[model samples]
Target: MIAKLTDIEALEAKGFDAAYPQKSPWDILRHQAETRPDKVAIRYLVDASDPARDEVVTYGDFARRIMGAAKLFRGLGVTPNASVAILAQHTPSAQTAIWGAQIAGRACPINPMLKPDHIAGLLDAANAKVAVIMGVNGELDYWSALVPALREAGVTIPLLACDADAQSPGADGVFEEMIQTASGKDVQPEGDETALAAFYHTGGTTGAPKLVQHMRLNEAHVARSCAIMHDLTERDVVVNGFPLFHVAGAFVYGLSTLSAGGTLIVPGRLGMRNAAFMGSIWQQVERYGVTILGVVPTILASLKATPIDADISSLRWLLTGGSPLPTELADAVEKHTSVPVRNILGMTECAGAIAVEPVHGTRTPMSCGLRMPFSEVAVFGETEGDADPSKPLGPDETGIIALRGPNVAAGYSDPARNIGTFLDGGWLVSGDLGMIDNEGRLFVTGRKKDVIIRGAHNIDPQMIEDALLAHPDVLTAAAVGMPDAYAGELPVVFAEMRQGSQAGEAELIDFLRDRIEDPVALPKRIGTVDEMPLTPVGKIFKPTLRAEAIRWAVGQAAEALGVEAEIAVDEKLSTRVMVPGESVDAMKDRLAGMPIKLSVEARS
Candidate 1:
């Protein structure tokens, strides 16, 4: 599974007769083209209302598109060391462009949701000489945002619009038109497995986004592992709902199915917000005979809310990630839909998901799953004053999760961030807290930064959240730490109730009191909300919760002191306080009296 040197040589001769057989991601489609040219490689839904409008492409056609893109890039002077940025939705041309860039140079997939200025900074960071993006529409104005970003960065890159609605104002050429005009003949098929092939930026939740460097083999290895876990075959049809910019969408759902010679289904530019498309998801699955489906917890919740009568007998399993799936919700979904839900755990640093529950294997409730065969996982902790901070913890002991594998990213763009990240044994610190159970199943407790310190005791918010989720009335729950004058920090729970369920704060509090025995771990306050703020990938946005808690704390302090105060918390958990008509020293003293450590800024 690690693809040793011996295995790489075997892969060339035994499997697929790959052109660039050092385990490059492109060889999957290449192999399929040779063996199954007439078979459907990609079946994309352009419009949900009309199934006849589905765009179908054969493996042979897909190969030609990839070659055409590669030819176009070479003509544009792209070299093996250069990089090309792609900022478009789910389309054959966009996907082909990614392969072409990887073959000729490096492919950088920028999240289209980012602001124009942020996109410009990333493009500058990657030094992209060319870009592919969607043109402006009534809904998405990607062209309008990208043009300014390119100009502001002082970059003169050629912009290729893949989804040009009307004639793009700044597009040098349309993607489809260029592919049709160019000859895909006489293209070189050279690839280096160790060479950097793609660059993905982190979510920047902790700080500014850092570029994650990935070699071709890293993606290929994980995709193979995913193929095995899903038990995919030529008979299987897989659908990807996640954006192509995400690792789950591109690598797990896209490349993995291709490796298995299975058809890949996509919904063009349709995301979780597309209510119409989402409403007809079951119908789409039945129409396509989709054997595998990828989703997140938020999407699952929405599907559960809006029930649709459709035959889902073809679905082998519901692969869910991007957030933790509560046991209660998982059971409810299975009971309602009769499809098993498998929880997966992964991060960008690992090139995508590193663990998944097997299709017909035993799954522990709320457990993320077992580590993939290609990766080495361990729980590590730091000891006070110990010279070596990367000491491994025993099983069932909570610590920072560490992983080392061929699937892991080579390193970050900034070498400084690489020091503490990679340990002496090549283990990459995951920054997530988890423990391995006796059965070797991985259980994610929470993020390292998400741990709440209540009167010097470490309290994991995930425990409280899980307890609340067990209640039948509770739909989705999130627990965070609220700054407290006495306890340093108190656990607070925010939940969204099931529709028509009349669960109040006191009722939830009493429910938790019966479930959680440890007082320190119990939520001090319970509040109900209509919905929880989620990240692009559908994970709970804890930073937003932390900021709201700080604001609430500041308001309470201001009311007590009869003065205005401003508060902010940064990624390092550093607190900043500003007070008008008060000395910095006086404010600091007052905060210190409340057992708080904060930097006081004087108001101008």
Candidate 2:
């Protein structure tokens, strides 16, 4: 029988998996290698140099590579429980490194896009002894300049480079080259299920990001639960484009596919410039007979805009998460693709997904669906004069959504962030606001945290706000999310300029571009406000600012289209523009290129 969230107890529960002893993620690979050595395990689609060729890795070869990397780790003096940080763009080699790190030591997948300072802070927090970084590529060279930057920040960890030049300093040979030469006989993992396996960094409410710790046991448990949820089998072909650093890329989608002995397909990183890859996604799905696909809302939007002519009858379901999926977009996808669209809800703290729309199940618009087996969810709220904010709220009452189960991370790396984030009963206090119906289905309303979900990446607006405040012309600044049709949300800033100083939107945007390494965090528009809404205690009233930002985005969109419409913005910032005597398709066509996303409806 498949395990349910209620069947599992706390992390400290004795003999937690006594009925079914957990297996290491490496063991899952070994079992598949032995059982189906010739079976194709991974296929890399859309090679930039050769678009026609796809690199395939069989189960046996995948296991051997992991074993070889394990031996290489042992040779480098990495012991069990040691932390190894990997910083590289999404690639087959990067995924191989993750498996190798877990077999020998703890794997910490650092975001490749982070600036050197942020990278240093993460490496320091993980206490990584060795860092594997991208080599001297044309772009995204994590080794060439990042090594010196990390060193300057007092991080003296040994460096391993992927595709590094032979003469590069601090490079202990190439990763692919060393792994091939190493013997695969001495691979030994001593950790049990509960032993720490990986450290994933996620944006916290604070200025600094928090390190989420997951155990091998958590991976095993989550994988099994997910396998059953998706009805995964050996015949299933799963495709994913999320980076391996993210939980879905590593555990929920990746490990779960392995757990069911299914073939996992890793496409190249998702970007607009890679039009060659993005445009041919449907053809790739047909070529591989892709049974299951995972995508963010932005990808769906792109696919809708550029229709691909390919037979997708083999596709069983298209799973979407990471950001809010619009009801209209979902309907459009289903109508075009003729595949069941399942919207899932998950977080890094929750290993991967805790809830998903069941196969052939009915769905409520914008609802994240029922909680999966073995995962417990509750709505926690506060009552007037109640000392405990952790009190469980009644059904249908909007409150903070708290989760508990084997899937949840053990705890955060920082003790300070751990406070109040975890309740007395081990329930993780998700910064999201939601409500559960009497039927136990969850409806996510909004986020209490100030972070914005920009496509696949979780952007911390405070990072940008802090940078804007340092500018001489900026007196006060607040960054918030503005609704977008393509990207779920775009970062927008509202700033009150100094009385005598002058700063325009373009100039401030240039200032932010120079300071912030991540362009996603940069504000799309900067509105000069007379005064920001402030609470009685002098804190910026962000809710009011967020509402204003959404309205402003809608107004701009309407003015650009030259359409007089009545617009209504929901709590999630989903806009509905009603234009008298205008057809939905025509209105949509007119507002196609607008920054804000609005659904065009005709008023009777």
| Top-scoring candidate (lDDT) | 2
Question: For model 1, which pairs clash?
Answer: none
**Cand. 1 Cα-lDDT:** 0.72
- Estimated TM-score for each candidate: 0.72, 0.89
- Each model's lDDT comes to 0.72, 0.75
Tens-digit lDDT string for candidate 1 (490-576): 788889899998878888898987565345577877877788889888988876776667666666776677777878777544578
Predicted candidate 2 versus true structure: per-residue lDDT over 415-502, tens digit per residue: 7767666656767777788898876678888776567888867877888888899899898999988867678788899999989766
Off by over 4 Å in 1: 1-22, 184-186, 189-191, 205-209, 384-390, 449-604
- Counting only residues 3 or more apart in sequence or on different chains, how many pairs clash (N, Cα, C under 3 Å) in candidate 1? 0
The TM-score, computed over Cα atoms with residue i paired to residue i, of candidate 1 is: 0.72
Residue 183, candidate 1: C-alpha displacement in angstroms: 3.8
What is the clash tally of candidate 2?
5
